[model samples]
Target chain A: MEIITSNQNSRVKLWTSLQTAKGRQQSGSYLLDGWHLVQEALNQAAPIQAVIATEAQMDEHLADVPQGVPAFQVTDEVARHIAKTNNPQGIFAQTSLPNNSFDSKYVHAGQWLLLDRIQDPGNVGTLVRTADAAGFTGVALSVGSADPFGPKVVRAMQGSQFHLKVIKDVDLATWIDDLEENNYDVYGTTLSDTSVDYKTVVPEKSFALILGNEGQGLDPELLAKTSANLHINFLGKAESLNVAVAGGILMFALN
Target chain B: MEIITSNQNSRVKLWTSLQTAKGRQQSGSYLLDGWHLVQEALNQAAPIQAVIATEAQMDEHLADVPQGVPAFQVTDEVARHIAKTNNPQGIFAQTSLPNNSFDSKYVHAGQWLLLDRIQDPGNVGTLVRTADAAGFTGVALSVGSADPFGPKVVRAMQGSQFHLKVIKDVDLATWIDDLEENNYDVYGTTLSDTSVDYKTVVPEKSFALILGNEGQGLDPELLAKTSANLHINFLGKAESLNVAVAGGILMFALN
Candidate 1:
């Protein structure tokens, strides 16, 4: 085990960079903090590049760490500096970014959720987790969406990213064309007259569900490309459902 | 219009106090920020105790504020102090806290959502908003749940609180008993043997759905008293669904 005492250590600098989207993109890795996330990474056999823990956390959860993984011990102060939350859990793992590219054949035959620039990290993460729970084959994130590897998204996903295929930085417009060419039915969410009630349609075995940005519903250009747009009918005064919650209802009900 | 420049102004001090739960309870009011929320308050004809805004905001949204309401113009610095978010919208209103007490008769006849100590303000607020979308009659908050009037919760609810009845500090256990005595079907969410698939159950016209806390789900004693307990079955590795997402699925499906 290596001991890191200084926040200025080169390794610490690399770990700190994982906190931001640009840094994660440049480094090709992200940080996972807390016991649950670290444990999930180990169980899923994710490519954990390194593990860092405070002495106390190392003492408590050392055995749970995968054998042969590089481990580092840091002081409480260093751990706090590396953590983003007010109350740091003291255990963290740096895992290589998973390949976010998938073949069109896989998209053709699997259940996919395509996100269009969903901005909130929590919302993005929750949708990923919900997609996982609904047994989605994969998630395709459009370019403008929040980084799936951001700290808040990682926390909210609870390691579901390791369990499911997550493809990012895709041109959803082109993806819709490719999906259509493969004979896959694409459903976009919207509230227009052309849209059918989500409950009335029966989902095929393999299909794509498109969710839009938080403030705006699906773009009209995207909506025009779908087999049929759908809406969740409700009676109350809320202008719209929280994106994640709406995604969950659609995923669970349609799946 | 009254102009107040000092952060130490007695009115400013009182408004700042509304940031905390104790302060809100003690003062019998809470703060609502942003044009959307303030406008909703006015539209609902809620009791607006005071309205405060930066000079610019007051000019832009002046026509929306009730004509007879007391208004204060504060400098940007004072507006920032009273605002909870970094990007303060510079418009705020102090509104009377709604009476949380409801006649037992209303509980007996209407569709209800009982939240059991759900701690996350976002989750609490989202659930309230979801309940509104599903056209639930009201929401009852158990003792341990985050304060519904908290700023973060208010922001997430997106003015839904003004559109529906949100009864706080409710004892869910006794509320369940009262609901049962009135022949209401109290369905609790759980994953045990006694619980059936949520998809299989037909919701009655007037029923209660009990959602539990984030980390730990519904308390066992409360679950025991439910007419039936239900679970949403899925194939993913996630141990559970997000509380708000779960509540949304249940509310939308069952209703």
Candidate 2:
């Protein structure tokens, strides 16, 4: 274990890079902040590149870092700068992005959450966690969806990312084609009168439930090709729901 | 239309006071940040006492300020000091403290969201917005719940606050007592076996649906008195949901 105290340190730059979408994509790393998330990442046997802690924070919390793991104690100012949070909890970890390639051969013949362009980090994370809890097969993060590995999304998932097969950067059309080949049913969420109640849409052997963004609903192109559209009836004045929450309820219902 | 350049000004101290629970309670005012929220507040005819803007932000966005509303321009540093967010849209408003009193005489019977100690600001805001969209009569904020007017909550609500009756600081027992007096059926969310499937619960004419905290869940004392204890049946491996998301699903179902 070595202590790096300077702002110019290469490791500090690496951790800071994970804060941006571009930086994260380039480095193939995402920043996991605070003690709890870092610990959870460690428990899941997630890929760990390095850990950064402030001297005071290290003394208070990270005194028991395992022998082989690389740990660094940096100046408080440098730690704050790298973590991007006023209170960093004195621990930040750089975790390598998992190979998100899905094994089509192992695709579960059950309910799945297909997210399309859900931009809110919290919403995406909540939906992923709910999908996992509702027993949906791994989440398929389609193009334009917020990065699940991003800091805000990670917190919203509450560590469920480790327990689920979170696939990212997929072509929805191609994914749908693959599912059709594998005999999977597809259901898209919509607010149309013709749509069936989400409750009535019984889960089949293999199925994919598509949820669109909050404001736009499902992409029209994607909606046209789905097996059928499902709607959650609203007796209240609200015309619709937050996409992630809607997705969660549908997954719970269908699952 | 007074420009507040001094951070020590009484109005500035009052605006900044909203950052803490004690300050919010002592003075019946809270802060609203960002353009969307401030705009929504304006549209809702919410009491807007003062507006703080930087010269740059004002020139770009402040054309719509009503004729009578008091507006002020501050340096970027001072604006940043008063703003809750680092990358503020450069607009901040002082909204009068929302009346926390529920008009019992106005109780006519409809769906109501009784939040039990949901302490997270984001969760509180999301629940408020969801409840409003679901067409609930009002949202009853319980004792341990986060301040509904907090900046994070205001941001999350997306202007849903103005659409519903937001009563805070009431005695939960007495509030429930009043609801029961008005013949409202009470239901509380719980993880216990005694809880029934939320989907199965019918939306009666007048009912109170209670939600619990993020971690420990509904208080046993409150759960014991409810007419029914309900739970979202899970077919997956995950346990429970984010409070706000769960509240959304239950509210949608019950509504």
Candidate 3:
């Protein structure tokens, strides 16, 4: 094992740059922070480029790292620089973005949650996690949504990223069209004249649920393309529900 | 309006102090960081201590300020100092915490969400917001939960704080016993030999759903006192659901 004390180490510099989207694109990898995420990625056999830890973390978790994976030890200062949290668990991993060649035409069955222009990273991650817990097969994100692989999202996911399919950067309109073509009940969350209360819709084994941007409902084109718009009935004076919470309720209800 | 240019203005210092729990407790007030919240506070007739805004903000929203309220114009630097967000909406208000003399002994007859030791501020806020959207009458926080008035929670709440009763620092165990005494259905989130599937329970007009801590589930004492414990059935590989998301699903399902 090699001990890296200086922040100027080339690997350290590369790990720090992975914190940004541009750097991630250039390097073709993203950093996994903390012990659980790193351990999770390894367990799932994600493409691990390197594993870095403080001496104490390595001492406790080294035996868990599989053979033939590159591992390094970094000083506390370097570990802090690489982590997004205030107090990181002093272990990390670098993994390539999962090759997601997910086009909706290929998604013929199982439940799906779709997001459009959902800019908040935390919301995106929570929605994805909810889809997982609700037993959905996959979640698809529109091109305009926040990076599903971003740090805030990765943290919010809490290892659900490894649990199910997270398809990204697809055209939502096209996906809606494909799901409709496949006879899936594509549900859009909006309360228009033609919309039905969510409870009126029977749960389906294979369907797609679309949640819109925080301030805006689904794009008009996507809304028009959905099989039917659905509304979550609010008995109180609250104007609307939080996007993540609303999606969670819908996922569990519909699936 | 009185213009405050210097950061050292006594009023500015006092407003900045509202950012902390100690300062809020000492001054008996909390800061509302954006236009939506400030306007909501005014709309709901929450106790207003003072209103502060930038020149630009005052110019746009001046008339909306309630008559006789003490309003001041602060410099851009001062506005940022008083806000928790990186790019605030350039307006703020100081309001006294609502007087909540809630003892479950004096209660009964509407939906309630009880949170026991949920420490993440965002989770606490999201759960409260979900409770409002789910048509719950009140949300009572245990002594060990995050402060309901903390900055992060206030931001996550998105004006839902003005929509419902948010009672903080109550004895959760005692509250549970009282609700049970008052013929309320108290549902705890834990799987036990006697816990029922959440879906099997018909939505009730009057019930209290108790959500436990994020990491350690409910306090054993509180969990033991529920009218019944409920479990959410998952069909997928997810080990667990995010506490707020799970709470959202349960609230809509059980209510």
Candidate 4:
């Protein structure tokens, strides 16, 4: 086991840089830390460019490593420095994004969640995890949504990213238009009397449920275009719910 | 504005110590930060002992302060130190636990959420916020649940603590008995086959819903005591939604 003792190591620096959106895009790589997230990437056969771990964290998981994959042993402090959270499970890997695309052709056959400009990474990640659990085929992240590769989002997704298709930087208008043209009903969460109760809206064979930012919901232009604008009726005093939680409830109800 | 410049000031140290649970409990105080939360506390007439702020934050909401309350002015760094999030709005407060006690007297009214060992503060706080929004009358935190006053929970709730009636450290068995005695039906979130769809369960005119931890759904003791066990059918690939989200969905649906 070769130990990389220096914090200035090129690999460590590169791994740290993946934390930022610009770095990830520039290098075409992102960091997957902790044993669980890394394992998820491996299970999906996500391209692994580099692996860094302390000896204590490596053990049995390294058995499946492919030939020529760069692996390094580093001190706990060095691992912590590269981790987004204070508690790193002493593992981190740099992996290329999946070579996947969301096609309008399949949008009419399954459930999908469309996230519009949700700035909170944790909320976005939780929504992705919930969408996966609710049988959504994939999540389409429109412009203004939090970066999927952001550390907070990754942690919230809790390993669901490996199995789910996360398409970012797409135009919501065009995406919804394509889906609607193919007979997909798009439901957006809103708080209006005109909106149908989420529970009453039966699950469709093909639908796109759009969730918006925590502060400002879906834009008026997009809301007007939605096939069905839905709202969860709250009998209580709360004005609304956490967007991720609201999305989860709608997903469960629709499913 | 009399600024407390010394780190050794008894009040300053006490505020700083609230960053951890042990410190919060030892001093019998919890730190509530941000203008909205402080204002919410004021609105509820919560047991706010001391209010601290930086110049900018003070200027914004100082007029809302009631007469005779001790309001302290501290350095920006001091305010930030006591604040739960790294990004503080520059307002911080120390509040004592309310005099309200958890007993049968408070159980006979409207909907209430009973948490059994839900350890994550964020989940608990989010549930509290949702419960408040859903119009629940109060919340009873069973043993093993996370401290509601913890920083993570406070941030997640977004100032809901002020609006909701909260009672912690109660025995679940005794609490259930009292609720039943008071003619309140108990509904618990479970994955059991006998559990009905949450939407189908018409909430009793007066009932208490029990939500458990993210991993552990509910305590077996509570489950056995519940008049009805309910489950949100997860039709998707994911096994479950985050407990906080699930609780929010169920609370709104039941109401």
Candidate 5:
């Protein structure tokens, strides 16, 4: 195994760069930390370019690393530098970003989750994980949403990215138009008088559910374009539900 | 308004102590930051021990402060010391903890959410917020759950705690037993083969939903004690839904 002791090492610098969206975009790869996520990447046969681990973690988890993958042993200091959390998990993998494009046929045949500029990394990641749990065909992210590959988001997603498609930077207005044109029952979440209670709508086989920003919610114009807007009816004093929780309820109820 | 510039000031020391579970318990009060939560405390007539704000926040949000409430104007540095986040919302309040013991009659009459040792502050807070949104009567936290008033939890709850009864450190097994004794259809979330799909259970007028920890899920012993165990059916590749998302789905579905 190759050993890396210095934080200034070129490959170490590249691994640390995956912490940012710009770096991930520039390199076309992101870092996955912890045994669970790295193991998921290996199991999914994700394009894992390299594996880096502290000696202790490599000793315990080396069996999960694919035999032909380039392995690097790093000191704890180097591991901590690459990890975003205070407690570094020690095992990390560099994997290529998945292709974000979806075939029109596949988009038309299954449920799709459209996120409109949802910003919280944790919320965005939870939404993707929820989409995976609800059996959505894929998640389409409009501009302004949190980067799906960011470190915090990847941690929250817990490897759901490998299980389904997560397309980013799409123009939601045009995408909604196309889904509607293809006879998909597109539903936007809104709380206007015109919006019906979500439970009142029956689950459809193939539909698109659009959730908006955490605070502002879906844009007024975007809400106007969907087949119908639905709201979750509740009795409490809270003004609204967390977007990800709301998304989960809607997806599970309407899928 | 009392001006507090030194972090060592006695009142400032007291406010800082409220940040921890032990301090919150000993003082019978907790600190709330941000205008929204402080306003909720005022609106709900919660026991507002004191209010602390920067001069600017006091100027902008003073109208919401109740008359005769002891208000302190602190410098930005002192405010940051009291506030948990990097960007402190200058307005804050020190409010007494609520009486956590609910009337047995109240518990028997309305929808109740029982959390079983959920440790994530965000998840616990979101579950409470969702319960509020779903019009549940109150939330009962088991012994090991996150403190409902923790900074992270309070932020995620968005002041919903003021709108509903949140009883913490309760014996959930006994509470569930009491709930079932009163003819409440107590439902426990589990993934066992014998569990029925959540959608199949019709919403009852008064029911208790028990959600478990994020990782371990509901204890098998706890699941075996409920009137019935229910699961959300899904076709996704993800192993399980996030506990908060699962709680939201069940709460909204059965409400």
Candidate 6:
């Protein structure tokens, strides 16, 4: 049993870096905070680097930690320093990033969600969670979208990443072309002259839905590549729906 | 035009207090930050107590500010102090809360959203915005839910409060009975043995949807009083959906 009290520990500094994309790129591991995420990752058999907790949390959850996994007890101050939330849960795990990258070479035949430059972390995370709930096979994030493994987005995802494949940094136009090659019907959500009502599209097993940014709707190039552009009419005066909510309603409607 | 440079000025202090529930309770007004929100309130003819902006912002948007309304030109430091966001938009309005209260004697005939103690400000605001977009007549916030006029929620709402009725501190139980008296179907969203699938509900002109808290679903007592408790089935293994996303899907489906 190892107990660390200083916030300046080398291991603590390394763990803090997992919150950023550059840090994650350097280490190939990201932090998972709170008991539920840690439990979910353990259950899903994702590669685990380490388990950490405050003394109180360790005493309660130690038995559940798998055999041979490195475990440490840290002071509450150190726990607070490493955790993102104001009130730290005191239990966390560091896990290897899953290798679920997709490209133009091969496109799987299933319900896929492609996010296009959706910058808000909350929207990105909620869309991923909603995709999982709506029975999507995977979610693909484009280059300018929020970091898929970023802390805020991961917290918003609420363990759904472990349940579904989340491929980061996807080039959506090429991916759309690959899906066409695989006989997949690709749909873009934008209100354009060529777009049809979202409900008009019948659900097929192998179709992908592309959601655009909060401010900018789908890029014209991406919309041109899609099989059909779908629009969910806002029945009331709101200028537009939040991208995640729009994605949720569309995913469920099309699925 | 009054110019305020010090953060400790009485007017700045008063404006800052609007971020809290108690302050709003006493003052009967809340702050609206950013150009879009202020412009929306002005366009909607919402009663404005005052407008404040930095000198640069004042120059850009002064013509849009309604006549006879008090305006202040504040320093950038004061604007940052009074505004909630890190990068203050510099333009703001202090407006009187709308008078749209309802009781057993009278209930409106249209779709309504009753939030049952949903705590997250982001969730509450997103739900309200979604309800507005889904053509809801109004939204009612229960006593324990996040403050309807709180800064974070209002920012999340993105001026949707001006488009529809938003009543705060509502007693949901009594309100449900009142809605029933008005020939409205009140639906409670909870996943339980007796709850029916949300899709089973037929859309009608008048109905109220009650969404529960994030972790705890609907209160059992509240569930018993609902015309029919509705549930949205999650097809995948994510366990559940975000309350706002679930509400958005159900609202559009049943609208």
Please provide, for model 5 over B1-255, each residue's C-alpha lDDT reduced to its tens digit, 9 standing for 90 to 100.
Answer: 779899999999999999999989999999889888888888888999999999999999878787899999999999988885678979899999998766544465878899999999999999999999999888999899999998889988999998888999988778877877788988998866578899898965588999998889987788878989999887888888889999999988888
TM-score of chain B of 4: 0.92
Q: Per-residue lDDT for A176-221 in model 3, tens only?
A: 8888888888988984535888878896548999999999878988
Clashing pairs in 6: none
lDDT of each: 0.90, 0.79, 0.87, 0.81, 0.89, 0.88
Predicted structure with the largest lDDT when compared to the true one:
1
lDDT of 1 by residue, B1-255 (tens): 789999899999999999999899999999999989999999999999899999999999888876889999999999999995567989999999998767555465768999999999999999999999999888999999999999999999999998889999888888988888888999999965457999998975579999998988999999989999999998787788999999999999999
Ten residues in a row with the worst lDDT in model 4 chain A? A98-107
TM-score of 3: 0.95
Counted clashes in each candidate structure: 0, 3, 0, 6, 0, 0
Clash pairs (backbone) in predicted model 1: none
Q: In model 2, what is the error at residue B31, expressed in angstroms?
A: 9.0
Each candidate's fnat, listed in order, reads 0.82, 0.59, 0.81, 0.75, 0.92, 0.82
Please state the CAPRI-style docking class of candidate 3.
Answer: medium
- Candidate 5 chain B, run of 10 with poorest lDDT: B100-109
lDDT of each residue in B1-255, candidate 6, tens digit only: 999999889989889999888888788899999999999899889999999999999999999887898999999888888886679989999999787566644776778999989999999999989998898889998889998889989888988998888987888889998898888889998766367988677856589999998999888788889888888877887878889899989999998
- What stretches of model 5 exceed 4 Å from their correct place? A101-106, A203-205, B103-106, B203-205
Candidate achieving the largest TM-score: 1
In model 6, which runs have C-alpha deviations exceeding 4 angstroms? Answer: A84-86, A191-194
User: Which scores better on lDDT, 2 or 3?
Assistant: 3
Model 1 chain A lowest lDDT segment of ten: A101-110
Per-residue alpha-carbon lDDT of model 1 for A180-246, expressed as tens digits? 8888889999865457999998976578999999888788899989988999888788878999999
Each model's TM-score, in the order given? 0.97, 0.78, 0.95, 0.86, 0.95, 0.96
> Which stretches of model 3 miss by more than 4 angstroms?
A84-86, A191-194, B84-86, B191-194, B203-205
